[model samples]
Target: MKDTFTETVLEVRGLTTTISGKRGEFTAVENVDLTLKRGETLGLVGESGSGKSLTGLSLLRLVPKPAARIAAGSVVLDGIDLMSLTEDQMRQVRGRKISMILQDPQTSLNPSFTVGSQIAEALALHTDTPRKSLRDKAIEMLRRVRVAAPEHRVDAYPHQMSGGMRQRAVGAVAISCAPDVIIADEPTTSLDVTVQAQYIRLLQELQRESGMGIIFITHDFGIVAKVCHRLAVMYAGQIVETGPVAQIFDQPLHPYTRALLSSVPKLHGQIGRLPSIEGTPPPLWDRPRGCKFSPRCPLADHRCRNEEPPTVDSPAPDGSEHWARCWKPEAI
Candidate 1:
């Protein structure tokens, strides 16, 4: 078996997803490229409708049918191209190798079945463990996620558990088979502040123990700071900036990235009021002709409006390097 700890478990290159609308095909995600190393966390952050969640779903080939399609690009997980897989072939890889914890656990979990039964079923489907050993494995997985009294809670239904518990249970199922990569899509959205912190810490612990690469999808910069080693900022279906967490936060280059950081309310700073990014995000259907963010960007010039910029390597404050896609990235 390949040592997943040292390998690039997932590589997503030029991923683009499109949906058929009443008028015509609209691009949901465009030219997204991401790579997740084993046992590392890559935080994907963006505003609503910025294609963060859609990109996460596309990684597992789980985009909704008929309307949504992976229009272009390759999703390579462990050297296997997900786009090229048949339904049956993809099934074997989905939960066992690359699992996803969805945004809402209440809707994702089965209302009729007990949480333990659901988790056991996942294990049985993905692994060759005997029926007698499945419950123990389920309980073990639950305990690993820091669920107290796992044996008792295992028999409880989704409704019996609190929102945090339900989310943890959903996580239990996703990581039950010890997947090589876990795509957590807004896992903390339904939890309270304290519980959200605990859940994130638990995920970090689990990632450390299992050596699983994590792709954390969230809109909150606070959460990104807490869990992510590196960050990717998406805008209008494309990545505008990517760098280490410290670099991206301290010395942002892209206009959109700078605007986002400036908008964040800081505790120490005495800037009268928080800086807000001007204008709303561009609609996917009515995307701008050149740079997608050019219309709303403060530094936009004729070149920005007429020509798309290429992503260029840049130096960070700490001597590290990152890339920003802009015609005129700000000097830090």
Candidate 2:
């Protein structure tokens, strides 16, 4: 309930991450820029391979090394330049100042350790809690995240819990440090519809309690609508559009954004063949000459095909700016 319009928690500029493969080097996350304010949620939505996950990892400097590297960018967290930090310094920042909730709790959680031990480990790494008090702090975290019977569940290993419970355990670890920001990359992917809804609400409640910023990466527009205050639509490693959630949903300026929204099933519309975006996304190495989405865009022209469009500001009726990377935003 506190004001969400507080100080900026994270700011990323021109974040470019590249991967070197047998095929050659290609940018997995290119020229990305984003900002997150305290208590606000920013949705990073796009189709598979749009580099949403890569972007999150790059923010933390966790991109796999040798094969993948952050080629360029500045990641400033709470006024500290993460890029300038030494490896040892960055380690202190990773779980203490920022944390990530990856999809698939089965993979994220350590099956060998009790859920409470995992949470306690994070607390030990980030805080100076007494050794004997770690268990109690861990139990408190489990209760805070809504794990059932925190005292009993604390001793349960990941495999002993349900999928939803495991995911909550992962959340408990992420929030145990009370980090300034959290990057949730499709964290609800393994849960059922009802469990997914519960998980989303749990995140909202946690955000309200801590006023921490969140970068939620997912492909589901419904999740974005429910949890995010703003959105950034990515395509082929580039951000195609970004603005307030309601403005972009009601009046999407980018063709790709419109295409993505149209693909979502409507509950009220007359039932018929569901709309689908024709053609597949271009591969990273062989991206098109101009606009990346030009090949499948109905509004594509010669200019669109030959020249990459710059991100331009398209002001909404309320005077807030909606940015889009398109040459023909007026066509919408």
Candidate 3:
């Protein structure tokens, strides 16, 4: 069956994260707004440096200190304004209310701590479980992620596990508290194809069990196709288009969105080389005056260059979703 999403679990508005250096302030993510419903997955797709990862960090108020910060935005999680919370309150919300599965486990996991200790620590921090039962809970969490020999493996340090096992261990920790939402930042990036597929199914199973919302961040359209209920395509730090996954894949409105979908590698039958987007992304510091994608957009005109394109929100026939920031949606 298709997604049966109902209630909105997360709503973001005007979310911007910026970094400062001698050259001046550069916006890593600008005025980004997105919604994720309970029991639904939203795919955040774009090339590296498109601010996808930064946007995820900003939602959790984890943007690196001093160098980068969430300059402006409202992050509302289940009617509560996350942006308005105090540091202590936000800390409470981080692993308990909202969790994150980072891109890499080798760097994310502390080598000194045993896998069991790390997972138990997360449960201890969030729940009132007695210290004695924490170890059992940690083992159960590992089992939930389909880790083999959880009882014994939990005692091993991260370095002792395979890459896939470490990733699964990280997943165990991320979902340990049964968070309302999980921000998966390309969690499958480093895994081989087989392991990647397994991890994806593991995540889907966990989401089904908990009805948690997920923001799956990746540039792989195939992953988007496999998991996402909706799509949000970013380019050079801005979301150029967003809509239901089927609608956007079938009929992308923005040129950049179309290009991205077109570049997805086909697998069914024999085909020539895969298509790719032309030109590199605009440098953040020297970004063009108007639409950041205008320079490479084929349909771009004088208006597109000099003015920010207005968003055209055309609702789908199924009442699913549709929206595009382009001067010429009719052209598509």
Candidate 4:
């Protein structure tokens, strides 16, 4: 028997998504690879336009249609290939086998409907719970997320709830079906620090109880450190580095990863101005010839600028293989 702690819940390989418009088609997600284990939280961190959000959407086959589509790669969830499923089958998979907690509760929750009705809608779509009992189940879910006076709040509309409460309601919707995996796409972006910490703790408690794997997408390294066990750094739609969180935090191999870590403000030392990475990520259509980050990387040389770096495997202190895409990871 495989160890439960190490059991793979989701595996993605060479996952590429394309976006189409009047500007034509461009790769928005390129050859991205990820693995999530049972009960583990994997942080997907990068700047805006780094494809962190799109990667999560693509994993669930929820990429906006007509405008963007998944052109390549495979997403295997619990040994089932999601790419092979038909639209109807995929609908069944969503909210049942897997779920997503989008970043904004305001957008996620319907202002027209009571929070209970929205949660009941999810339960109805995915489960066999009788119609009469869905409200009870919804209330139970609200309680699970630690909502105050869940019974009263359950009947309130989205606009009536606090930002944190609304986010918790969104979480209740996501976990209503007991999915094997949950993709939380910057779920704490709108909340205050206290509320964000509470939300993280709530997610941790839920994961502990359900043993569900989570792909936590965020731009905040502090939140990543608090919640994620592994880390994947994205750049220009591609994953540049991935490994155990502590190992990567201590010894980041990719230049972009190092630069990102360097920019984070420190608490222990004398307060000083934060270091900033120069230049923004390139547009998808205008990505550089070799390494996408080479243009901005201080360590880039002729080799890095002229040739694409292959993903290299380095031994991590935690006995896991740390993967980095760079010509000279040692130079950093």
Clashes of each: 0, 0, 0, 0
Candidate 1 local lDDT, 190-245, one digit each (tens): 78999999999999989889989999999888898888887899999999998888
Candidate 4: regions farther than 4 A off: 1-4
TM-score of each: 0.95, 0.97, 0.97, 0.97
Kindly list the per-residue Cα lDDT of model 3 for residues 209-276, writing each as its tens digit: 99999999999998999999999999889998999998888888999988887777777845888778
* Candidate 3 lDDT: 0.92
Candidate 4's TM-score reads 0.97
Pairs in steric clash, model 3: none
Between the candidate structures 1 and 2, which one is better when assessed by lDDT?
2
Better of 1 and 3 by lDDT: 3
Supply candidate 4's per-residue lDDT for 304: 89
lDDT of each candidate versus the true structure: 0.88, 0.92, 0.92, 0.92
Q: What's the lDDT for candidate 2? A: 0.92
Residues forming the 10-long window of minimal summed lDDT in candidate 2 = 1-10
* Cα displacement (Å) at residue 129, model 3: 0.4
Error of model 3, residue 123, in angstroms: 0.8
**Which of 1 and 2 is ahead in TM-score?**
2
